[model samples]
Target: MNVAIIDYGSGNLRSAAKAFERAVAEAGLDIAVAVTSDPEAVRRADRVVLPGVGAFGDCIKGLNALSGMREAMEEAVHGAGRPFLGICVGMQLMASKGREHGEHRGLGWIDGEVVPITPADPALKVPHMGWNELDFTPGRHPLLDGLEPGAHAYFVHSYHFVCADPAQSLASVSYGEALTAVIGRGNMVGTQFHPEKSQATGLAVLTNFLRWKP
Candidate 1:
């Protein structure tokens, strides 16, 4: 399988690559992986893995600089209707707007905004880090198949995805309130946590996504 790890100069591209590589190796598939900043590579991939870190506002800016690649990226995942995975702030970019560093627009692939998790109790940390349990409901989706519920995944973010349609949410993880941990609407799968850092469970998730022929 050929998996394309997109590098828009703003994501956790290196770590994402290593994670997928490790998972692919364990899965016994000689997956061809590349960390590409080129948009054309994204359009031509068998599977697309979009991962990001840093601020959402800047993430959009960096991606916009590569308009051709960005256009291709938008089409490949959101437009061309291919199987795509988004992580961290990359997942937030799937939303309509990101309110970090003022209001910024996202891909609008999913209807919602990326907002800071304003905890009722200020004692709650802003950036929810460390391993958290995923409250997933088993589905026919290939991404979740064979993956047990209440599995632990690593998370590191200040803002989280607020999906417009709750039915679209595949799973969620609780920190203060239940944050949208995963969203799988059609061929697109978005996650707020970093599966690359989630160890075995994380590897299994990525492996499932890679082998996901749908």
Candidate 2:
């Protein structure tokens, strides 16, 4: 299947690319990966992976600034309803707004805000770094395929997605509180953590995305 990683000039495209390649090799699946700022590529892909790093506001602005990319992304999210996997700030972009930098609007694909993870226990880090166990709910979509309830995955983010619709949520992770780890509704899937950096569990998420018939 064709997969395109939408690079809006603000992501570590190389590592994301390599991670997908690694997953494809391991899964023994024929998949295409590209760090494309190209609108045409976004339109043509079977699935689009929107990966982002840095501040939430900046990422939204970066996505908005893309003349060709903006329309194409709208098409991917709205027109085609193509399979979407968002990483870190990319996931945050799915929200309605972000409290990070003066309440900037997101893609509005999902209703929510990306807010600072005010740790219930100050001892727990704000970024929620390193490996953490992901607990999944029962009878969800296929994206959680082969992933156990206590599966560990890497995380590196200060803020997490507080979704408006609880039903959209797929999984959660404990960091003082059970934070929303992943959410999938219809064709839109957002992850508060970085799957590319999350090793095998991360690869499984991507693999599910590649094979996802949504």
Candidate 3:
């Protein structure tokens, strides 16, 4: 199987590609992982991964700059039912809009908006960085198959996803207030944290994602 890790000129492409490569090997899978900006490559892949590590507006701008990239992703994931994963700001792009710098349109894959994380406590900081434990239903989703309720994942973001439907929120983390950690619907799934940087928990999720059918 072919897994396309889209290179939108925004995310940690090399690191993410390496993580997926390791996951594929560890999982004993025959998937070919490609880091490409080619839209056709995405269209032909069995699975698609979108990773981002930057401001929401900047990331979206980079994505839009790639001709046919969004449409190809839409065809592969939405039209063809292929499993899709979004990481960091890539996940945020699945929302209806992002409120960073200014209002920006998103892929609208999930019913949500990307807003700044406002912790109720003054002690908590913006750009909620570092490792945090996840709160999720262990068996609710296949992606979390081996992940426990409090699995720690690396997160670094000032913004968070606010889901319109709670059911779409597969997991969350507390940074003075509850922030979205994972979101999913149908063949699409997203992680607010960097699974590539989360070490064991990250690898486990990546492995599960490799083995995931939906």
* Most TM-score-accurate candidate: 3
Off by over 4 Å in 2: none
Give lDDT tens digits, candidate 1, residues 96-129: 9999999999988888888998777778887888
lDDT of 3 by residue, 67-151 (tens): 9998999999999999999999999999999999999999999988999988888988887999999998879899888888988
lDDT of 3: 0.93
Give the TM-score of each candidate: 0.94, 0.95, 0.98
Pick by lDDT: 1 or 3, better one: 3
lDDT of 2: 0.85
Tens-digit lDDT string for candidate 2 (1-214) = 6789988877778988998898888889888888888899998888888889999988988888877887888787679888998888888889989989688989888898888988878688677798999988655778888888898888888888899998887899989988999987789898877788888888888888888887
Q: Higher-TM-score candidate among 2 and 3?
A: 3
Against the true structure, candidate 1 reaches a TM-score of 0.94
On the 0 to 100 scale, the lDDT of residue 212 in model 1 is: 75
Model 2 weakest lDDT span, ten residues long: 135-144
What's the best-to-worst order under TM-score?
3, 2, 1
Task: Give the clashing pairs for model 1.
Answer: 11-52, 75-80
Poorest lDDT segment (10 consecutive residues) of candidate 3: 205-214
Residue 191 CA displacement from its true place in model 3, Å: 0.3
